[model samples]
Target chain A: MAKVLMKGNEAFGAAAIKAGCKYFFGYPITPQNEIPEYMSRELPKIGGCFLQAESEIAAINMVYGASGAGVRVMTSSSSPGIALKQEGISYIASCELPCVIINVSRGGPGLGGIQPSQSDYFQNTRGGGNGDYRTPVYAPANLQEVIDMTMDAFDVADQYRIPVIISADGMIGQMMEPIEFKERTGRSLPSKEWAATGTNEEREPNSINSLYIVHEDLEKHNWKLDAKHKLIEENEVQYEMYQMKDAEFVVVAYGTTSRIVKSAIMDMKKEGLNVGLIRPKTLWPYPYKAFDEIPKSTKGILTVEMSTGQMIDDVKIGNNGRFPIHFLGSPGGSVPSPEMIAEKIKNILGGEKK
Target chain B: MKTIFEKTKGLTAKPFHYCPGCTHGIIHRITMEAIEELGMLGKAVGVAPVGCAVFAYEYFNCDSYEAAHGRAPAVATGVKRVHPDSLVFTYQGDGDLAAIGTGEIVQAAHRGEKITTIFVNNAIYGMTGGQMAPTTLIGQKATTAPYGRDEAHAGKPILVSEMMATIPGSAYIERVAVNTPANIRKAKKAIKKAFEIQRDGKGFSMIEVLSTCPTNWGLTPEDSLKWLEENLMPYYKLGVYKTPEGGANNG
Candidate 1:
């Protein structure tokens, strides 16, 4: 395993190529443009394909086409571009085509900012498109997880025959970190039993489409997707919990924000304040069960994010409003300092000083 | 007795979902014949567009993908590039290719992707129950343009073949009609040649088939063909607009 320092977005693109993704269709979007730029240079050398679509909608549709053809394909973009891709993404899921989609989420309700934010938490985990579909979301806290999770993204997508999203923020996209590329197994391209590859003497004509007019037939297809999602939840829910022994306050965060929470946890430990963090690795089958396992002695949960209280809602749902949850963060591209988070922990503990 | 019918191996046996008298059938046969004559039937993949032809996936027996409105070209680029040995083409209606997917189609041709496109221009939306399309003739009456199309209000019909012909990346561009037996023969030849160009790895090639939509035009099957001859052909003139010499692979 050779170690190399690489930016998260670039690493994500390289991992996809290594995983046998032969087509890269995308447009240049901030915080994630490096993915396409990297693909443009690398894909041709490997005898793969790369295209810069006119817009995000076009890009995602191209990905849908390539994926439907029984080849590994992917696209990357920021928040606004991702929003443009929602219609196509929903159709991809409906058709049960396997593909990898990366969203280097930036601050936004509407073209909000190009800075890092966890504002897309609900959007990514909940499928980020029209429909009752869910895309398995991977939230990587560092560069290594970015590489590992991205490679896993293809496996999960193909395993479930559904779209899998790697949800990172602008900070992770831009930051450089050392990562060791792991030798991956199960790297063979999916067979063409259902793919839109031409029907040769080996098989009859196969169509990859999503236009089911009959309500009952459409309903049955959606139900199949639901069952696949249930299977994913049963087998793939993953998270990392830290230093929870006798802790009264638990910090919950994900992606880059979770890394910041780690610094805060260390500071809180030295000050004789018992605090811990629960960093989620998978955002879709969100580690709610892990949060539920928090010690009974814990007083409350502090949810930190780079958005305006978006993920806190999920935290509240997981805790079932069983504890007093406090939210703190700067919305739209502002990263909350470790000091501020640690101070908030001290303040919460000081009032009920032991 | 067999004629070219035996050559259409890539097409399915199922009757098209298009309305009666619609010329999508003619265009489909032409594409199938092209694949057969080029000896690329086993290596060809067709991209089907949305709209009246949204169910086109059911008819093209070759491996096919249904693209969102106006995105067939972009998707074709991905599929063709990934499997460079395969012959790729897209079949789209005016609304799907001209209005919503204008950006994708233009760029695909501009980049000279090694693919063929069969653009069907019926002058009005058929599947969505008669609406104004980008190629809807000026002064033509439809569901959206009840009082006849007004060039001042909604721009003139887009001359798609002519517009794409000017691009340097485009190796061949032609407009044809399926309104009559003679025109149908010419249309078939043009479409077959477009596929031939791509088989040679020549850049982008396109054939716009000016088709008839009887139900949408409020005319009987016979009148729809007559209307296409009289009204549509006058504006979307027939014949080849551009053709590359030697049919050499540019890339």
Candidate 2:
């Protein structure tokens, strides 16, 4: 697989096809519509299903059905459309099925704007649906990472028996970069005996369900889900922490915003400010343990985001509120440039001896 | 020599969780019996809905799924398209099939999906404590409609079977009730014929069973059955509403 220049959404779609996802169900939503359009052309060539569902509600439900049959399935949408899928997502989680959902997030409160925004940070990391459920989310910083993260999303969902989301903002979805697709393998997915494929002589009837009617029994079901989430938190936290050695200030950001924060850190360093940055790769089991280990010299942490103060809450939680937290953000499609973020960091660390 | 459970096939060993006298149990038996007689027990996969019948996956012995409220038709369409050889069906209630999932049901039939649906219309939201469903009868009293259903204020109940019969892709559409012995026999026949349409690859099929909700109606099981026979039956007439040979919506 030679390296090729592709937009993030197209790269993500191509990676899923390489990873053995045979079905793609999606509705047209800005920032991610390219994914469905790509699948509509590509999947049929391989004898796979590609449906431009009537709406996001229908699209997600179709994915739910396909995943229930123990196949690799996926759907992509933006913020408002993702909200419509919450009900189906809850049921899919309750049943512990494996699938991928991509949210190329845009600004929101109600059809806020289509420009880049991380306002869905809370929604994506916390499962975005009702009930006590947690779907692990991969926060990709660039187009290449978007492709790699989407492929990893399928593997992790299959391993954990839960949905996995590759959460990118509108900018990440639109940005173009060089991506290398992985080689297809002899490792085909294990035959799904429980799949609803004519119920051949291989196995007896099987059921994939999310309902436990007895009230007491339902509680036990939730407890089992709780146990799975705890296991994920214990094993699946990923991050990249930079220049924490003898630093006085820390900067925390993720996804596309994290890239801007890194550039801001370099500019701040040129100005003789001893600042470091922490970028979370997996937003669910957020890198709390690693973020807490930043040197004792760290006095304050400034968080920069495309949304006003959403991921700042997580940064504070990771720090145990030990360090003072400062937030600088531009909401409703106004993204802060590197200079602006650097200026905010300089203000937060005013006149302190480096 | 066989028990009631054996007489009905394609059902799992898990005990039913539905409340006693809940018409879902009766409907489940009739569908399972039809599958057994048709010898499609091995090839059948049912999609259940959220609500009182949410746990339907446990009762249907074949491979099954429990979909979110009102999206069973979309899910069944997915299952059928993926495994075109399998017989797919969605067992849904009025609240799920008519109210929340109206678009999915209409679109799946409109696309000529080769699947079957067993739509149970009991006139109220049985799972969510007797709220007014989209199919709640005119003048019917429910928890939300405590003052009886007011047509001017609440709008008229939707006749789903009649509505879907307008779609060109729908091969069969029928409405029947199970209040008396005669009506139960008619319902069984209607259900069997609906399944037969899918068996013959005739495209989408549906049978809307006008059912009784004893708990929500605040009546005994016996009284609810009588109410269904006397009042509900007259308005929701029991007969084939549409079919390929004898009715409308033929493509």
Candidate 3:
């Protein structure tokens, strides 16, 4: 109703509740612990339940359970913890259950540092667990975007009967900003007709399952999932094209790192250097069409990331060698300065001219 | 047609895929019958774990979830929380419950999650062939334990019912075997009582049934029953470990 200042992780929790999520199951992990903490404190007030699970694996399975029982459920975790959740996420995806998952990504190869990083690009966007299934991955860059997307995530999950992920870097979780919770008045979503809410013997039992012992049945199930993913890819791909009017160079990024890219773009504009940004709002069902928006005269494409380069692979696939793609990034938690990114753009632009 | 015997209402018309003499069918019957007898079949939600009972979703005639290995308790907790008045239970095997899923089960009990679990301690992993389970008794042979389970190497079999009974949240914990018809009758009673504790919202409840795995144990069905009585029951110890009535409701 009114603008309120809220931290990113806490806002994620508030957004889920606003989306009519009544159940939260999660284990504590850095940069994302506040989500579960906020949920635990606030959910009970609304007659909701916030359960701090024993482990990430158990937490995600609990989400699967609640989702199967035909309710809006959510879980959040950092990178290592998200790794443990892959199993349950895979199961949820396979079972075609609706739930929201939040990944406040931190540095990782092992139990890496808790500093903000986009190191989990593949883990969130790509098929993290075993399967031919995909979850809609949303990389919200700011607190307001976090709030907006987190609310819509629940709806989208139910609309398509799929898990939706909101991947924010550690910086986003720790940062605070002004936001408004706009109640969703989006497209109508289907009711959970296939849920495992007991039949009371009035109807045949509804089983929430992913097991298909027969190879042919499993194939049919997989193809059915593929069709759903295809529909999502067609109808739901989202991205923001910033200052592409006459840009000769485009930097592609998402989440927190894209903010730095924007600053770099602004700085380069003052210097009369043509620079623009294509920020992906959706990772899976990625904004491949955004590449077509880049002026054919563009000298080069620079992909910025907080990792060594995970999203770059997708960028490459999207660009399909249309223009020479360049990279500027740091691994672990170290972020590149705006000046550094502008300088890299200058270098790439200079090289492309020759 | 004079109805001398009809199938338990708890089960589905689909015949079980369990191996002959596996004894999983027995456990499934009693667990479902317990729910049916309690008039909970209408509200019952089941979670089937990964093991021989992985397809329990197919057998149990109720809303069911096929949980990942050892995560059944956690899943059941989710279902129970959503429908607190409904009956939620998990059917898990020794490998699923004691090995990979120990954290979920122990924490569920600690939190006093209002759910029931039917833990089948078959001493070996049957679905993937005869691998040694955490409940495989010391000196018991399995595919993985070619030379028999050495106590020094593999450690003693975990007594799940005893360990569960020690948890205060566990309103009912019992270990029973289905080796004999009288014992089978007792197992059914224990399972029913476990569900009753959940029905009363007393707290967490678990019934650990010592079942036979003939195909995996490489024993005849009859010998498997004898093996369960002579070896497994002695270590597992059939008795009521905990009850809501402080040992008064001796199931």
DockQ of 3: 0.88
Q: Candidate 2 — which residues are off by over 4 angstroms?
A: A183-198, A201-204, A352-354, B1-6, B13-23, B218-226, B249-251
Which is better, 2 or 3, measured by TM-score? 3
Estimate, for each residue in B1-251, the C-alpha lDDT of model 2 and write its tens digit. Answer: 85544446566778887766778878888898888788888888899888788888778878888788789988887787777778899999988998889999999999888899999988889988999988877889889999989999989888787888889988899888887778777888888998899989988999999888899988899999888888777777766768877465321
Residue pairs with clashing backbones, model 3: none
Q: What would the per-residue lDDT of candidate 3 be over residues B4-112, giving only the tens digit for each residue?
A: 8677888999999999998999999989888888998989999999999999999999999999999999999899889898999999999999999999999999999
Ranking by TM-score: 3, 1, 2
Candidate topping lDDT: 3
* C-alpha RMSD over true interface residues, model 1: 1.4
DockQ values of all predictions:
0.64, 0.61, 0.88
Report the lDDT tens digits of candidate 3 across residue range A193-260. 79888988898999999999999999999999999999999998989999998888899999889999
TM-scores of chain A across candidates: 0.95, 0.94, 0.98
Query: Candidate 1: lDDT of B62?
Result: 79
- Which of the two candidates, 1 or 2, achieves a greater TM-score against the reference? 1
Q: Write the per-residue lDDT of candidate 2 for residues A1-354, one digit (tens) a residue.
A: 788999888888898998889999889989788999999999999999998888889988888888877789999999998998887888889888889999999998898889999999877877567888889999999887887788888887887788888889888888899988665333234445555655653467777777675899999999999998999899889898888888888888898888988888788788888788888999997888876688999978888888888888788788896888888887878778889987776766675332
Candidate that beats the other on DockQ, 2 or 3, i.e. the better one: 3
Which of the numbered candidates is closest to the native, going by highest DockQ? 3
TM-score on alpha carbons, each prediction: 0.95, 0.92, 0.98
- Residue lDDT tens for model 1, A1-354: 889999888999888987888789898878898999999989989888888888888888888878877888999988888889998899899889889999999988998888898888877876567777889999999999998998899988888888998999989999999998887776444554788777664677777777779999889988888898899889889899988888889999998988888888888788788888888899888888877779888988999988778778778778997878888877868899999999887787677342
